[model samples]
Target: MAAGRSLPCDDEFLCAICLDVLCQPASTPCGHNYCKACITGYWDSRGLAHCPICKEVFAGRPQLQVNTKFRDMLEHFKSMRAAAAADEIPVGPGEVPCDICVGPKLKAQKTCLACLASYCEGHLEPHLRVAGLRKHKLSEPVSNLEDRVCGRHDKMLELFCEPDQVCICFMCLKDDHVAHQAVPLEQAHREKTAELRAATSGLKMMEKVKSSSVKDIKGSMQRSKVESDSDVSSINAFFSALAASLKCRQAELIQAIQEKQEAAEAEAAGRVAVLEQEVAGLRRRRSKMEQLLQTKDHLRLLRRWPSLQMPAHSEDLFAPEPERLSDNGPQFYAGIVRDAVARMEKAVNNEMELLFHEVRLSGSCEALKHATAAEDPIEDLIFRSMPKPEEHLRMIQRQHAVDVRMSKCDFSPGFVVSEDGTRLSFLEDVRFCLPEVPNGESQPPVVLATEGYSSGRFYYEVQVRGLDNFWVGVVNPAVSKKGRWILASYMNSWGCFDASHLKKLSLKRKPEKVGVFVDCDTREVCFYDVDAKTLIYSIAGCRFNGESLVDFFTRLMTSDDSNHRPKLYPVFSIFGSHSSSELVITPVSPGP
Candidate 1:
């Protein structure tokens, strides 16, 4: 007996002799199924008839025939297994997935032009079987099906309106394009293919021009480098004969000229890099077009024609020339030599003290002006407000990083608060005893941060790892454990909502770390998905004025003043059904 494959196998589908899936299965009178050849060979070897499973001997040999019904069923099962295996591949990177698949979309094998949907082999079986779908054109998997559709009509662009010079749908023929001349998509594809040759030829020419431009830029850089190196060598020789002060000036001049040469060469190198990239891109596109042209299949050529990405190129295809290296080294050296001679003469006379001081301060004054501009309050504000994409959360953390500590109020037992007031967790099978609200005696599993915000902006992050359902937001600081507080609803989706107003922002994924940002000036309380660096929700025009002053305070610490500013303290807790209720006050930190 042979072993079955990795997939789960049923005894009914397996042949007793072969042990693998039944192939041309034949049933015996003793009610046992086996491969036709296996059963025939078994009886022939012993010259006797017997059931392989039950060992029941037969008097005479029976004629063998293929079980047509069972064979069909076996084939059907094999097909199903094959389909399942084909659909094992989900939508991975760079894979066009079947839009029809519900979950973990399967890799697409074909794209239907008429349906405008990609389909895996399993899902594509229906189109192969269905008579109506058989007529619809299908091509190799294409990602951009939307591009094949007519934007105006919202239908597959099957025709080209000659007058308007645009792709149009069948519906357009009886509507906007009723009076205009139109042709079949394939006809237009053939016409365009002829024109495509010219277009691709132009691309080749562009590629050549850009390549030449790159070569020219690199050549210029090489020449400039050689000239600059020679100049530097001459300066080194010249400066070796001068005095210490004169030598210092000579060194400065050499460094300046070398820096200038490097800048110019780097600019040329950068231009060459861009031109080379464009040239390579053009070659790839031209190669794809050439391959398409070689294919004799008109339908494939037509289908792929739309997918060919042809970037717009200006009539002047040449790359811009890099900035030329100016011959400033000789001029600068000459000026330095004249200044050195004049300086010695002036010091001997000692008559231009004020003028010397003015000359000394000229460069320093420009640098000081730049520093003053950078420190301008208005400029700083604008710069801070407009942070780069994905840097929004980090910028907020940097600017408004606040210290958060879990306040240990007199809320009985069952809940564990860390010594430093940074962590909060619940005991096994033990519920927390939190604040008793005004309306009801229901205690929420909530804890407040020690630090409170009354003015300006504040941001803090809470590590909610090991917990599923939780809420992290600003709450009114309570005066005591039994003081007044609003009971916010258990939110599965993260968002901002309050007593007077409500706004919800649905979260796409569960985040391990959650950041809370509060801006008093703008009156915005925003929640951030820290790892994703995305703003989960924000409530604008929010007035966070809590009545309870003692809701959060340093435990046994000295504070004689009872009067405190109306501030909202950061709060977090495990709401809804959760496996773990632990929460950690994460210190604000920058991302790698």
Candidate 2:
């Protein structure tokens, strides 16, 4: 029955025994007391024989007490605390001790309800005891007293009317409401009090809903804390596994680098040692040859008499006969020495070749090692599996157009002509005309003739006034078939032209101020739908009058009125041959 250090005794109150609050109260048993449920529950499952409170041996069940006296004492203490709190009035609760009287003041007496005015009790005697005050009923001061103003005049309540249902000053009831219907303030107050009760009931309902929502929010916050802790643990576990994997990979990479470095160093050292040994052998051979040359016989042979004659001096007679010398004498010795030196030279050359071969092999090994160490394995694998350079190049060549031909024109016109022979030209001052036809394929046919102007591009200029006759089309020979004519022209006056065959130009009304014309006649006057590639309008069997090319253009481009005077012939033609006849087409602006 002894209490565990970590576990609170079952006999003890779950509520703090020292504070004696009843929250989750429990009990303990002894001559001394504690919470009843606390002691019973603490020893319920234990098989010990001692009491939890006193640790005394008990052969039988010890009786647990509820300690009602202690609980009664706690309740009394709480009541006393509440009563004490209620005895003192707060300074802000519409009531306070009177400053002048030095005594507690009743909030109800501070202001006279009948007079509808505020005054301290010390100053309120006149309002209560005045000549007609005995019939007045006073009320406790209200914090919202300022809100009870005159409804009609929006002024502070200064008097209460006995007849009208309103609070008002004497002057208001006497003059402003002389002939109006009114009621006494007491009657109005009763009605307003009922309205106030209804409003307060509605407010209570709203407050209850708001309090319930707040409790739900608190519960949700606790759940969110639990979920957050679980998420943190999961994240930690995942990153720990990732860290372990990364550590393993790092160790492997480091080991591989170390092994490669050691192998390369050992190989380099082996090559250096081989070269050193070969050099040392060469030096030894050279030293031995030098020593052989310094022998006495060899020196004597080199210093042999300049001439074959007997010495004149007797001292020179001691010199031995050169013919009686031993077979292995200076000459034979010289031959053997020369043979040995030759053999040593041959051995040195062989050793040098061996050393050079090792050096070359070592250099190749180092280059291979660097390549292996530097290249990423994945990249190397991908590169090795890729298509050959020649094959890749061939594939690209097959898929793309290497050589293609585009349209070229020798000369082109820049105007549009109507079937009525009215030609409109747009002379571009700073702009170049592009064939409006799709891909310039269905452009009007015009005689493109070159002249002294050798520049491949054509330029012209024209001026337009408000909503008058304007030029709007394009012409290029590259888009026109030979002997076929195309024109895009509009006029203010609508008219139909009679021809053997006709086609209309379906050009977009782009509000463009320029047009180009190309001449390549095949006897058919065909008008193209520039953007659509279909024939929009055409005129066939129109005779090509043999007129001067320049005169024809000049007449067509000139304005009909003299006042406008068509400032300049707004058209020019690049004629390939001066002798050919060509038709021109013109475009007009569309209506809004």
Candidate 3:
């Protein structure tokens, strides 16, 4: 092999007939080796037998035999080439190299703990071939096989101490592990395997939970984006409607002022036209007189004067007095605009105060709307007025169809109830009166709902029209209506709008209809802009202190009152000096 190192591999290993490495080398009598298949095919093609290398002729087909020694040498050469190529390969990252391999070590496949050595596939072949070597423990490749042996005892760690939870050698059993619980390494491994299987199952379950949580979060984000778009649309619609209203009012005012100016101008123009006709007649008479004077004809001048008699001079015709424009006219109209604007501004101020105070009232209403519209027997009309989608998820036990009527006792003179007792309108120049209170406190004008509730949930709607500022919601039944009192002022009373005390709802645009919902069990009350279909505010987690049992019993015993639980009555308030609009209690249809 050393003498043949300089020879070309193609010349030494390749068969001359096939021009490739010999598959099954065969020798001819001429001493040339060729592939058995290649030489047979060549001889058959020509129908003659001859040595390809020497070209020696044979009388008949010469017998060729396999060159066993040459074939063995070729196989040895192929194996040596492979081994040399493997030696040139370098170790890569995260790969355990064979400890026994010299120079560039090959990647290890397994480690023998008993032998305290790791080996590549090539080096580990003997362990597989020899029965005694196979008995040595083998595992997945590891970098430090020496760590498996005990450092103190210099022996294989064959026992597991349960008490100390450390691996120990057989000698450690008599020393440090004598009083500790110990188990065979194999037994401990089996126990640990069972524990790991259980842990893997738990990890799989946790992965599923995390996946579900991620899905829920994605769903929430998508829903939030949709809701945000809806809110923007609703707000834009509200402002557009408001602008239209203001423009309509502006046009009306301008038309009114123009009508008055046109009427005045018409009268003044009529008087001026009459005066001009009289002036023309006078001028014609004067011209005739001048012509007569120039002609020296006294008779013609006298005749023209008699025929075109000059009208008598009158102070009314000559003075031409016209209606004068009042200096305060612009100021008066401007005052009207200012007053209207002031009312609107006040309404906005009150709404802003409510919005800021009830910052926490906002929540998802889409779920509640669906529950009512799809599942509950409540009418979808109740939800139609909602400006935004409901996101507040809660179990609706039942829907209450509450019938509210205006109470005369709590009504003001300005507020006129409808003949059917379902509507309330404000009339101008009417002074609202409060019934005499048992206590010294004054009462503000407020209309109360005839019906009351002490427990459970109730919902209702109020249609607000022709008024910019109006309040609607529930209040305690015991709230005073004496001289003057603020809404939601008393600790027990609650209402949607309470500029004097607490605010329940903040509105961006004046809603035509408002919805009120109260959940006594949850101690929550919510108000909605019905037309916009959005939540204005919510009063949540309301708590009330009870007086003594005797006092509570005394109130409960009253003939008209069966339940002493604080009954909530629907209440309303309106601002502005005069308004024709009414705060009507609209009918609510049950959802199917």
Candidate 4:
């Protein structure tokens, strides 16, 4: 009975005497439980020891003892009750709490939309028992119960209004949503859930594709790094060999100098040995002569002079001077070194140029250029996966071509029209003047064809071989051909500029010819690269038929034209300083 506690208990756990939960519970012989105090008081008040539940009598005074096991069970129940009370969650502000609960309201488990009330488990038991309450609709507890019921009719909201996209009550079907497309709420929920699932599936597929692309890019980067490392290693080895050769050449040069010095020293030592021998003879003779002067060896001295005769002392007895080493040898070697270096330099320069050319030829340079030019990271990734420009063009063309003619009217002063009227050129001005109009706005060069189409499909080819900036497309009859700077800028016109500004139709190569196809019935306009047979860009869902023309004329407050149906004229705009550039409306090539 504690607040916020809804634990159920058996009747046996209650004291029969006090009609309350048991305390110090004890059992009688009749197997009925009672509080010890309550049982004892009942027996004493009756003046007899008897079981109150079964009417069993006890002869003499029965020995009363506390039931220890029952006391333990009562203590366990008390602990659990206290724990449950502590675990109870108090209702907070703005939460749907039990309406029937009085004191410290409990959080509601469910709400009955019919009764417009929320109930906690304790108070909700009545809904399960009472037949009337059971008939009420129940749903997860919500804060705004009134929103689930219609304000006008006071009925539960059960249907969905598809036209207005709102939840409607049952009464709405007979009232506001009677003519509207209404369906059961469950059907709408199912359809919306299915759509979400499909979108999720598509997202998952895209994630897989992006993940695979990332992996491929990483793998390519790793391979490129490996190739670069290998190239570095080869370059290092080449330089290392060159250094070793230089060192060997240096050692050879030093050895040649050492051999020359040894040869010169040996010749000088031989000459000096001959000179010393001559001096020895002269000394022997002089010694004998001195002995004779002393008279005791006069006979020996005279005999030695005749026999040896004095050694001839000539002025030619001189050592040969060693020649000064010349710088010629070293200079010759230096020349050889310089020539070797020059040859190596030339070879390296030529090899590097060849390698650079090879890289360019491999299309790596083009790929790198495009990657750098891309504005977005995702766009760059997609661009890398695209096929070659020629291949893409071929796929779009599908061999489609058409005959077209240049317009004569609205020609700017700088242009030259061909004699046949099939070609238009922005040739250098010779002697042309601009026509003065009432409006101050000067017209940029533009032209429109006389023929137009309001129904059926029509195709044409325009040769834009030398032009850099030009426009091509079909325009509404109301387009300002006199002073309009851009064709696509106007609401009734559709044009693609062959310039960087129009990224979708930016051409890598100056298309020699362009094919324009227009389907009036479908309101589709497509441009193709004629030579490459590639589709450039397309504008679909255009409004260019009879109805659109009528609307356009209506807005201008003008009557219908002489033609039964309004027609769209092929238009062109050209602006360039060079007169040589020409825009020729050429006929389609004959089919094979």
Instruction: State candidate 4's TM-score.
Output: 0.34
What global local distance difference test value does model 1 have? 0.69
> Compared with the true structure, what per-residue lDDT tens digits does model 2 show for residues 1-592?
0011123232342243333545323344335454555455555767653555468767777665456666776566556555644643434453533332335543334644555654554345655568777566555555555566656665556555545645674457677667655555566677678989999997787677556545655665566668668977997897799689868975885586567667767876777797688669667756765665667785564554333223366353355633421233346545765797697666556445545444433422232333344344553453243333233222222222111111123223443333343333332432223334322343322322222121111222111212222222222222223222223233322111221223333344422233221121222233333322233344443323323346545655885423211110112221212122232333322211
RMSD of 2: 33.1
Between prediction 1 and prediction 4, the one with superior TM-score is 4
Task: Provide the global lDDT of candidate 2 against the true structure.
Answer: 0.42
- Judging by lDDT, tell me the better candidate of 2 and 4: 4
lDDT of each candidate versus the true structure: 0.69, 0.42, 0.67, 0.65
- TM-scores of the candidates are 0.31, 0.30, 0.41, 0.34
Clash tally for model 2: 65
Better model by TM-score, 1 or 3? 3
Better of 1 and 3 by lDDT: 1
Q: Where does candidate 1 stray beyond 4 Å?
A: 1-388, 410-413, 432-443, 478-495, 546-565, 575-580
Model 3 residue 298 lDDT score: 69
Which 10-residue span in candidate 4 carries the lowest summed lDDT?
483-492
Q: Ranking under lDDT, best-scoring first? A: 1, 3, 4, 2
